[model samples]
Target chain A: MTSLILYTPSGVLAKGGPLKLAAKRLKKLGFDVAIDEAALAKHLRFGGEDDVRLEAIHRVARARPGIALATRGGYGLTRLLDRLDWSLLAASVEAGTRWVGYSDLTALQMGLLAHKKAPTWWGPHACDDFGRDELDEVTPDCFAEAMTGALEAVGFRTESGFDGLDTRGLMWGGNLAMLCSLLGTPHWPKVRGGVLMLEDVGEHPYRVERMLLQLHQAGVLASQKAILLGAFSDWKKSPLDRGYTLKTVVAHLRSLVNVPVLTGFPFGHVPTKVTVPFGVKGHLVVQGRDAFLGWDEDHAHHHPGHDGHGHDHDGHAHHDH
Target chain B: MTSLILYTPSGVLAKGGPLKLAAKRLKKLGFDVAIDEAALAKHLRFGGEDDVRLEAIHRVARARPGIALATRGGYGLTRLLDRLDWSLLAASVEAGTRWVGYSDLTALQMGLLAHKKAPTWWGPHACDDFGRDELDEVTPDCFAEAMTGALEAVGFRTESGFDGLDTRGLMWGGNLAMLCSLLGTPHWPKVRGGVLMLEDVGEHPYRVERMLLQLHQAGVLASQKAILLGAFSDWKKSPLDRGYTLKTVVAHLRSLVNVPVLTGFPFGHVPTKVTVPFGVKGHLVVQGRDAFLGWDEDHAHHHPGHDGHGHDHDGHAHHDH
Candidate 1:
């Protein structure tokens, strides 16, 4: 049984019920879940005071559990980025501790990539995805298999125009807003020719377009082989937005950049998100309307000069066809 | 007679009533006001298509109006930054045109600063301010005085802390979100030891803090002389935010950086906003809870190698005490 430690590193966990339920479910899934002492701690809107949360993170990293999962994601990790112990987290990664979560967790994952070239997972949060009244069938299954090294490829149905689109690059990116927030910062990972994945919730289409345009204008899109757009859900349409919609936003983005912008990846602030490795070399292939992102663990382990820490360390490594 | 042009550069003007009313009010304030040809044009949510808006910007620059005021600010100018003719706009600035507006206009203003070292104004829009059903007396008065070079300073009350404090630097910045969007982009203005002013509407405190943290972590705040925070309005309180407020956000920011963070600047998306120069050398003085920002036009005019386009050309020029 793999040991998993659940902690709250971001927003305040309002109630303990969801966390308990999540632990129960994760335990049933053979996670051997152990909740952190400050998992239910609160400081205003954060899980704990800045120092407390920071300590909890270092604690989890020191424990070197098989999985270090966040209870939920709201708005806190960016604050901890400057003071975080990256070496400790990276050492834990070397010890086979798979840090998993998305949303606010993007900050940590991106920081690890920028500082130590370590990989993390873009997957479900404990409270948000696993602690639901009813468990999502695909989320936990995908997460468990990925943790156990049994899952290699994840496929989804994207828009049609990318039928012959076969490309390989470092897989990176998470919540669109979180990614934008790290721009120009020391924690920003300078990954070129990478397949960027992005998703967001509650952001209007115009806001989404603005963020994408920021990435585009900053020349991030041009450096990438492909741009994978996941779910941009929970946005409200304004009365002033006559014909302006997400479709139009995507069309405008496509017109602006030469990079292939593929949509409809199963991820984001949605329930059925796939567990994808954040810093792994991924091979993306498109057949008709179906898209697949696959990675080889053996190749990842043999990365040059890396300690073979369960995932690829070099984001610049090219996959030989 | 000073010539002013009212044009729609960003969001669509759903109704013509506000534009007409704004024009009438500006004319009453003893200026020749001309509404742009496509002031009322609509394309989805923008004032016009990208080319249309871009052409309108160049058109306004060619006209060399005393003031080129945006009709409104929503979400469109970021698209036109790459295509904008910076030299033409700089020539217009040299010819005595004062470009003005806040919110989305921050993109255009910051671009001018980055590309041509030209100054713009962080001021009002047509619809949201002057065209209100009940006009704000202070807003129009400040605009008129700032336009004719009659107003040397604007003062406001702030929390008592920095009495007898005096500092001078280049005055810059506008809407917070717009400023953050330009980070890591070519449009970003690299201003050091400058007074950075910021404000935003409808963004939660946590979001605002995250953006501020991005700036901080990117080494932006550490280089600034002082930070002037204006009104951050219209954000709703969530049940999860027990005691998390803008006050707490400011406190957190102050703890992270040694720079003085002063509040109560009379700007932002409010009715009673003061028109401030965006790229001019400003002298900031504080005495007993009262703060004043003053600029000398003569000093701004004699800048080295600069045509002295009504504002300072160099953001790095230190003010001799």
Candidate 2:
């Protein structure tokens, strides 16, 4: 049976309705779920104090479960980056522990990439998405396939602009605000020739423009092969915004940078979300308005002659469609 | 005659009530006040379109008035930084144009320092402070003194502990969010051993801590001589937070970083404010609970045996009490 560890590295699971329901579903789906003792420990707005959250991470690293899933995401992992035992986390990754979550988890996932070049999932958190009463068919299926090493690619419908697009590079990026927070810090991975995917929740178009400009000004956008926009939902519009929007911001960025930015990515804070791996070689191909991101267990086909430290060599390689 | 240019570079001046009143007051106080044509122009939330705002800046640079004051501050200058003519502004600064304003102006002022080490005043905007029904005594007095070269120092009370302390460095920093926006960009000034002063409005203590942590992680705070925190006001506390406040955030930062974090800075979105010169040598001395920040027009006294731009060799040196 697949073993999983339910950890809380962000805000406390006050009610944890989704937590209990998600565990029940995971058990029904034939996975052994172990709830961490500190998962519900509350210290004000956080899951626990900084030391408590840090200890949860270290404990998961030592346990090396099949999946280390966060109970929720609010704001806490950033406080632990400087003091985290990255080597132990890297060891857990080597032992086949796949860290999963998004939102605030972007900090830890990005930190892992910057320090150890280890891979994590930019997917659903335990409570927020998976813990719901009616779990979406797409989310659970994709997650299960990805976990069982049966999923290799995700196809989505996008706007038809880049017809003959073909590129393969390291897949990276998560929540935009969290990504912006990591800028200039040691945790920001110096990625080049990457397929960067981005999404956010509850951010205005102007604020989104500001964060995008920050990345553009830092030369990060220009260095990437392509930018895949997932979702920017739950933002309020001001009467002051005559015609400005996320589309306008995207158009302005496209006009400024040479990088191709594609939209209609089915990820981010949404009901039907797609699960994708971070810090791995991803092959992107655009056929008309359709885009596909695929990877293989063997890095030979997707990333030829690339000797990056992030390349997992344990041979879990297989094609999933 | 003391000439001033009232321009709008950020949000729209919907009603010219404050703008007109401010001009009338300045005229009464003996100054040639010329309002820019675009000062009242409105476009969505901005003072004007990007090109219009850019033209206003260039026009002011060419005119080189005694003072260039912004009408109000919201959020717009971040868009114009890359397209701004920094050299022209720097030349205007050399010609003794005291570019003044705070809030959003922090972007332009910090950009000026990053590009050419020119000085600006972190003072009140035209409509926001001066145009009010009654201006605060401290507000106009500090602005007048700083503008007329009579303001050499600012003194305030702080928590007791840091007494008999004496240090000096280049005075810098404004608007914590704006400063963080410039991180990892070409516009971020590489100031070592500098005295950084920061303040903001409507940001939670967690966000304040996050930005501070970003600076600390980027090796910015640790490189400074001291950190002077101005007001962080008008923010509401979340019910989730037990007892955390801005003071708690400061205490946490002081515990982590080995820099003197002093408080009671009378700046930011407050009625009683202090205007100080940016990019100038600042002499900091703490006597009991009283802290003073003094600077001379001649950098020789405070910043001895150091020459990396911003030194006025023309010798406009005068001490103000």
Give the winner by TM-score: 1
Docking class of 2: medium
Model 1: per-residue lDDT, tens digit, A245-282?
99999999999889899998887998888888888889
Query: What does the lDDT come to for candidate 2?
Result: 0.83
Model 2, range A195-225, lDDT digits (tens) per residue? 9999999888888888899899899999999
Clashing residue pairs for model 1: none
How far is B80's C-alpha from truth in model 1 (Å)? 0.6
RMSD of candidates 1 onward, in order = 5.5, 5.8
Point out the worst 10-residue segment of candidate 2 chain B by lDDT.
B306-315
DockQ of all models, two decimals each: 0.78, 0.52
Candidate 2 lDDT over B224-279, as tens digits, reads: 99899999989888876767678778888998889899998887888777878899
Give a tens-digit lDDT track for model 1, residues B1-321: 889999989999999998889999999999999999999889999999999999999999999999999999999999898899999998988888899899999999999999988988888898889888998777887777677776557777788998987988888989999999999999999999899999999999999999999999989998888899999999999999999999999999999899878999988998888888878888888889877777766432222342212211111222222
The weakest ten consecutive residues by lDDT in model 1 chain A span: A307-316
Task: Please provide TM-scores computed only on chain A for all of the candidate models, following their numbering.
Answer: 0.93, 0.92
